[model samples]
Target: MQDQTFPWLTTLIVVPLVGAAVLWALPSALRRFARPVAVAFSLVVLALAAVATSTFDVSTAGTHQLREQTEWIPAIGASYALGVDGVGLALVLLSVVLVPLVLLAAWREHPDAPATGRAAVLGGDRIRHYMALVLVLEACMVAIFAARDVFLFYVVFEAMLIPVYFMVGAFGGLRRRYAAVKFLLFSLAGGLVMLAGVIALYLNGPGGPQGFLVENLIGTQMSTTTERLIFLAFFLAFAIKAPMWPVHTWLPDTAEQAPAGTSVLLVGVLDKVGTFGMLTLCLPLFPEASRWAAPVIIVLALISIIYGALLAIGQTDLMRLIAYTSVSHFGFIVLGIFAFTSVSIQGASFYMVNHGLSTGALFLLAGFLVARRGSQRIADFGGLQKVVPVLAGTFLVAGLSALSLPGLSTFVSEFLVLVGTFGANRPAAVVAALGVVLAALYVLLTYQRVFTGPVRDGLATTPDLSLREKVVVAPLLGLMLALGFYPAPALDLLREPAEQAMELVGVQDVEPAYTSTSTIDDGSDQ
Candidate 1:
């Protein structure tokens, strides 16, 4: 790990936090400036992230860089540790990039309006609260990905629930309260379990001023039973955060009820924490346990892939449909991580970034559609292409990307995942491949139902995307296209970390069965 004199990670975490506080503390007279102020803050954080990315040493990205450490809780040996490997950097970049876009998209969200009864009793400036929550969430998201201490990671991981809870409950749709409470309950349960694991891990480590630092914890000895138990503790938290099967029910409801921009962050950057934890913390800290658990995790991943797609196919709510697709996409990510090949791990890391772009675009565009129509139901509108060609076209592209259409960024990552998984476990890969087919069904069928029939009664007069909306979507699509054709930049950042993960997990890529022969010289030799 390369320690830095300058604390880049702290600045990245603090700027948004300050921004959120500024929005919250803004006087009523200046409340009108909340949106621009929030946007400005997010942009600043984005600039800092760009500089950090430029300074990152890609060659040694397998090791942490720009690390900063100082003692925090001496009693328990915890410290304020922060760092990023290639995988962590990729996720950090994803978090910062998405926040600005989400802010811009949500500019007019939560407008002030007269309320009755309970809403009146709870009333304040809704837009201000919403923007503040987003910035706060952004800060937490960055901190979680950059955290190098297990205790710090856990704190930020659970702290994130605060902003998200309000974003959904206070500013979301009809079922906002229900969705937010459910999300909180599920996440808190997972966190409590992981908390037990974190305490157990520190006790198992060499006690010091910084005992909870991930670097310090790596390779500490433990019995099979102890390690496996700890691994399951961490795994359960990540799986629920991952929203993997059995624990995934919160996602669709939350997505359906939350504001569109909030959903983008929730599924796009936030959910990645689970998979990120699995790769960076789980496998490295407990290799034997990861290997021991691989078979069951792989099976669950396959089920997530197939089951999520099948459910997505039957969804009537646009937001809920997008949420289910994420469940299916995350399955591919998990499969890649546990497949234990360098290629597969790299693919999983790449998928995390690409999934954010594709799904973020889908959610934002769906939000635009809902804003125009004032409804989230797919059956509420039809024949929109002619009336809103630009919106229709963009939605199609985003949907196609979700389905892993060739020449799209998602296809490259998903292709790598399947190919790599095939080398390790062919049957699992084969079953997961069925998700690709099901993805096409859900995406195209949704498109057909929402955009392709004769002009629906009210949609013919619908306006095309406004300039602000277009600006919101253009960057995400551009990046998707750029990465789709040329993934080397992302792959370069991901490769070393992936290889390092394989090393830490004590595994190697499966060898190819066929080899080319270069010496066929019967007649030529004669």
Candidate 2:
């Protein structure tokens, strides 16, 4: 929303990268300050994000704002372009907000280790490598969301895997290498597929530099078959990232192996790329294909919703459970987008933001529990509420939010998604609604096993949330509550984008088949 004249988006992207470079270059003796430095840089970015949002002109909501551009790769029609629409801005802001918190949560991960995988990877300079990667990850995520050029987005999209790969492979649990490779392979396979689409778009595009800019690509003429093929390529990549069913195999393994902070970013923010791509690229670029594919996509979304929830309910590992829930949540997002109505698209957009906050909190808090207990198994501890009330309480709130409790932030978006889906596809909506019930079962069932039952031995010794940990989680929890109660501002920002999206696809809300008075008069006549 801020003026493009200010260059805030570039600053937001560049600062973290600069911080990462600084952290990497620091002398070994000073590496201990890496966490603080990372946090400071991330906080500045967050502040800049806030400032950008403060200046955003919601009245011009549907189009990209705060545009910045320069020539790059003229041969390929790519540019050093950056901008944000409401949806993209929300995702960028979410990344900035979560990075600082993730750094804080991971603060002690390097320090307390004497001889661990993390210690081995960075040797004595554990903090530097860890925090530097976090900042780099933040930079890439911002670039992905802010990119106005399709080629640039693809570059950043694949580039994002680098930091995450190291974070998980070098710094994670025993099977970290395996999980990291699985993640990379899955992502690369998708990326390669999407690259085909990108190349196709470029070849078929309008002449000159304007071809790759999103603004130019919209509504470009293409044959039905070519559009469908490109749509499939792009959708495959996004679906793998979204981890929608069949293609979702890598997520649970990675979540179970990666550190809590890494898992948080992977699921909370990066995965949003899939649904975001669907809304931003797939529908607009290939409107007819999207409509043609809607029925199949909606069915897949419905399957993910129910299947993910079921798997979560059956999980014994806490992290795996959380990972499965995301599959379910992402289903809601995809369903909303393909439902082809204003309310559904807006709900999907808002859901992206809310899910990031709520799920990020859940992962961080769960990390704390794992750190204290030295285990990731859900059955490893019980009746924690009596021992660590604050920690247990925080977990409860986050879990409830995950299940879409009535007043939680997730609830608002989830409700909108279902309502919107019902309008577009009643059968899919009906099946997807069952996911809510399954969600409750998983959240409550996990709680009952880990927090509510009789206190197990050694549980009493588990410490309550320290002030630093509480400070780390407070903002996320507060945000969940705030958005839950007052979602109007978010809805306002999302409304125009949703309207524009609807316009792009030539969709409008369908009036109800029968009005109340008309139904009554027909009944009386009968």
- 145-217: candidate 1 lDDT, tens digit per residue: 9999999999999999999998888877767899999999999999999999999999999888889999889
Which run of 10 residues does model 1 get worst, by summed lDDT? 114-123
Report the Cα lDDT for candidate 1.
0.91
TM-score of each: 0.95, 0.96
Residue range with the least summed lDDT across 10 consecutive positions in model 2: 114-123
List residue ranges in candidate 1 displaced over 4 A.
Answer: 110-124, 513-526
Cα-based lDDT at residue 95, candidate 2: 96
**What TM-score should be assigned to candidate 2?**
0.96
Q: What is the C-alpha RMSD of each candidate to the true structure, in Å?
A: 3.4, 2.4
Residue 299 CA displacement from its true place in model 2, Å: 0.6
